[model samples]
Target: MKYSKIFQYAYIVFAVLFIYDAISKYMSNGDIYYPSILLAALAIFIFFFRKRFSKKFDNRDNSK
Candidate 1:
């Protein structure tokens, strides 16, 4: 599989795990802080992956 597809699948798994964690936390403790923090972290992970891939592709295109 391509690296991009691998990244995409990883993102999906991370998202699913994050959602499940958030829901479990909410149900167990009724606190929003931890879940919010986890969500923010997941967002950062996605953003980083996006930027990294974009840069990689951009550089490749520019060099050609």
Candidate 2:
């Protein structure tokens, strides 16, 4: 459970890294990397989804 929480926040870290990579690449060649942008978007979505899921899980656990 602890590890799951840790990994949830790790998604934010990975999103930051992906955004940085996109910015650096754009600065270097003035080209957009769709994959990096997509991954960043996906990471953000996953982070929020995980957060909501965890909250529901906790609520369920508490009700038991």
Which candidate wins on lDDT? 2
lDDT of 2 by residue, 1-64 (tens): 9998999999999999999999999999999988899999999999999999999999999999
RMSD of each: 3.6, 0.5
Deviation of model 2 at 25, angstroms: 0.4
* TM-scores for all predictions: 0.52, 0.97
Compared with the true structure, what per-residue lDDT tens digits does model 1 show for residues 1-64? 2676567567656766777777777789997657655775776688678867777987998999
Top TM-score hit: 2
Cα-lDDT of candidate 1: 0.72
In model 1, the Cα lDDT at residue 17 comes to 74
Off by over 4 Å in 1: 35-64
Give the poorly placed runs of model 2, Cα more than 4 Å off: none
Q: Name the 10 consecutive residues with the lowest summed lDDT in model 1.
A: 1-10
lDDT of each: 0.72, 0.96
Deviation from truth (RMSD, Å), model 2: 0.5
Evaluate residue 53 in candidate 1 and report its C-alpha lDDT on the 0 to 100 scale: 79
